[model samples]
Target chain A: MLTKRIIPCLDIDKGRVVKGVNFINIKDAGDPTELAEFYNSEVADELVFLDITATHEGRKTLIDVVKKVSSVVFIPLTVGGGIRTINDMRIMLEAGADKVSLNSSAIKNSAIITDCSKEFGAQCVVSAIDVKKEGDDWIVYTHGGRNKTNINALEWVKNVEELGAGEILLTSMDKDGSNNGYDNELLEKVNNIVNIPVIASGGAGSLKHLYEALKFGKADAILAASICHFGILSIKEVKNYLIKNKINIRL
Target chain B: MPDISILNTKSANFHSVKKAIDLYNKQNIITSDINEINNSKGLIIPGVSSTDTVMQNIKDLNLEKIILDFYSSGKPILCICVGMQILFENSEEGVKPGLGIIEGSVKKIPKLKNKFKVPHMGWNQLELVKESEIFKGISTNTNFYFVHSYFCDPLDEEIIIGKTNYSIQMCAAIQKNNLLAVQFHPEKSGKDGLKIYENFNKMIS
Candidate 1:
């Protein structure tokens, strides 16, 4: 049977892990490669490195960081943030990233999703949609979840899947950083509408929350950042909990 | 010093395979050179890309004949994902013919009654059917990273060494003499994945 994936997300800036990871056992908390190695030992199914770096030089640093991290860790890696063009996706894939997540660029020029998927297989393209609930409907947000778009979240997900995106990385802006849980309502609706895999992102506070996303929301994977970064929960612990709950998790 | 050569299909990600081999202190060369591949102790056909494109690239580079030549040499050759798909005679994904090294056909994963996704993406466990050197250190039912819509259905069931279930039991790995092919990406499958490469490295050595 296919196992549910547990992913640890890292925010990288200028080749350094920006999020203040306060794990005492970690010798270098800022080193992205070191953190990735830690996750590997913890049995993380996958890793997502969100490049929070803004400048061109930072992008270059992120690429180098990707190469370095991929060389050290053997698991699948997904890189997102500031990936604007096909060339950017190519560079990241060549640097050993298994998948590239496109957010704002995909919204601005949806053709990029088709083109990238055509050049590289649809499996390489990940359509990342950031949404916030409004008036009983979820609205898509861009520009790092600050600016809102007129496009409806459910509709955009359907469009991306049709556009050849292999998977959907759905993040709820309202639930993001809230430590509450995933927006199960949004996840349930989107999962029902799309045929591709949906990765639930943002607001993963506990093991039960991750379970809810997979059980109620029907997410194929869960992306957690704050909980893992602050040493509150390890990937192994989460997998164990999921296993005990009869969830088919990769342990 | 054993030399492992990764065939450069132009579309495949050879770096991850190379890196995996590098961890075991073995040297891997990424090349389209027929002579280099023929001379290596082992050859790895990595994944990523459609079957048609990969076949066309191999034919264009004239590496297809060399691959067969290497296989005849009886030195181990490992094919991964799309690489595994092309080992068969034909595929539902492309019009081009496969290398025909293995008697099988690549078909799209059939949709289940419950509607499991087409591209069986993410981590999945391998159900070993028979013992093989490729999975020497890896335990049974160990999860490996997979991302594909099509799967290989071998005409010879005896060749199958591993199977995985998405909606149904699919052939995940096969072994026919010196030729070993898997539908999963060992290089992207974490520690257990690396163990596969390590086992392969030991086999060739």
Candidate 2:
């Protein structure tokens, strides 16, 4: 059976982990490698390192962070932020990233999806779409949910799949940082459109929310950030909850 | 430790494979040179591209003969994903001929009614059918990471040692005498994945 994944996402800034990671066990909660190792030890199915620092120098350091984390963590590693070209994707992949997530750059130039997928198989490309609800229709937002695109969320999901994206990282801007639950309605709608795996992100306040995302939303994976980072939920706890709920999970 | 040559067809993440094996303290190299591969105790054809591209790359690197030679020489050979698919006669995804070491044809996984995805990405369990050195320390039904759109269909089912299900029972791992291959990437499979490399090293020395 193919198990659903519980991924711990780390927001990296200037090559260091940020975004309210307050783990008492980790001496340096700011370190990317240590946080990655902690998550790996807790049995995180995968890890995503998003470079919040969009500066040129930050890009160079993110590569270093990816190399260090991949050296220690054996699971799949995905790096995003400031990935503008196929060459940028190559640099991260060469640094040992398994997949490169495309967010702002992907929306700025949708052709990068086709080009990256062609150069490095479709499985290596992850399209991250941030969306906001607007009168029953979801709007695609870029620049970390700051700028809105004219693309409809469902239409964009279908177009992304046709453009050769292997996976979709769908985030609900309203649900994100809200501590409510994943937007299962949006997730289910996107899941219905794309045959490829959809990773449900934003608004995972508890284990039940994760369950609902997989059960009601049918998302292939759940991207847990605040819950795991704040120690409210661990990756193992999420997997355990899913297993108890009759979900096929890697425990 | 004997040298392990990860044959670089100029495709796939052999570096990740090299990293995994390095944890086992194995001497390995990622190279396309025929001599380096022939001299190594084991050869790993790590693949992550279309069959046509990998096959063409093998020919370009002049590794087609080298790979066939190593297979018959009784040296351990590990083929990954597309690497495993290319061992068959041919594939539906690509037109180029495979190495034909294993009598099989690669076919695309059918799209089920919203139940299963095409790439079959993410973690999936392994159903061991027969004992093989590659899975010496691995458990049955243990999840391993996989990302591929097609599956292998061997003419002789007896060669299949590992099986997995997405929508159908597809061959996940295979072994024939001294040759071994897996549809999943052990290097990307965490602890159990590293164990696969450790077991592969055991096959070497």
Candidate 3:
């Protein structure tokens, strides 16, 4: 049986990890390679590096970071942010990324998902959807959640899967960085519609929150940023909690 | 000196395999050169991409004959994911005939009442059915990373070594003489994954 994956998401800016990682072993918190090595040692099931700096130079820096991290870390590494073209996906995959997550770019051009999936296989393409709850419906947000599109989140997810996306990374913008919990309602709705694996992101405060996301939200994986970056919980600690709760997690 | 040669299929990810080999202080040469691959003691065909494109590239580069020659030579050859799929006769994912080195056809993982997802993504525990050198030092139920839509169904079940349950019990690893192939990607499977490479290295040595 496949185990639930616990992934640590690192926000990268100009090639450096942006968050203040409180791990004692890490000397340079800004260095993605160091944080990656630390997470690998801590038994993180997977690592995600999102380049918040969406620039040409920033993309180059992210590639260099990916190359360095891939050399040290053995587990799967997913690089996202600023990935607009098939060439961009190629650059990251060739640099050592197992998968590339498409957010704003995918929304702008749904055809890119099909093109990327054809070129690098659907398993290599991940459609990242940022959704915000509006009155009765979930609305899709783009450009780092600054601009809202009329696209309905539920409908978009189904379309993306048909477009050949292997997986969906659903983030609840309202719950993002709030540390309350994940939008299990939103997750449950999306997970029910898509056949591919759903990774629940945003609003992860404690281990219990992660567990709820997986157990209640029916998410195949949990992508946490603040909880891990601030050292509130280590990957092992989270895994242990999930295991004790009878959730099948990778240790 | 590198004892293992990883084929650069142009579609598959070779860096991960190289990194896995490097972790054990072993050297590996990534090349599509027929002579280099044939000369190596062991060869690994890493995973990723569709089988049609991979096979087309293999035939285009004329590596098919060399691969057959290597297989017939009885030297250890490890094929991963799509690499493993191409070892069979053919697949539903593509129209191209496989290497036909192994007697089986690649079939899509059956959907199980919405309980199982396609691509069989993420880490899953291995259920060892038969003993094989590739699984040495690895315990049963050890989790390994897997990302594939189709699974291999061998005509000769005797060659089956490992099985994993996603929605159904499918062949995870198969060994036929010196040719060993897995539906999972060990290079991305963490510590246990490295152990697989280490074990394969030991076999070659």
Residue pairs clashing in model 2 are: none
Report the C-alpha lDDT of model 1 over A35-70, residue by residue, as the tens digit. Answer: 999989888888999988758999999999999999
Candidate 3 positional error at B99, Å: 1.4
Please say which candidate is ahead in TM-score: 2 or 3: 2
Cα miss at A30, model 2 (Å)? Answer: 1.0
TM-score of every model?
0.98, 0.98, 0.97
Model 2: lDDT of residue A66: 89
Q: Is candidate 1 or candidate 3 better by lDDT?
A: 1
Q: Per-candidate DockQ versus the true complex?
A: 0.86, 0.83, 0.85
lDDT of 2 at A210: 91
Ranking by TM-score: 2, 1, 3
List residue ranges in candidate 1 displaced over 4 A.
none
- Structure candidate 1, residue pairs in collision: none
Candidate 3, residues B1-205, lDDT tens digits: the string is 4688999888898988888887764668989887788778999998689999999989888889888989899889999999999999999999999999889899999998988889899999999899898998888989999999999999999999999998889999999999999888998987788888888888888
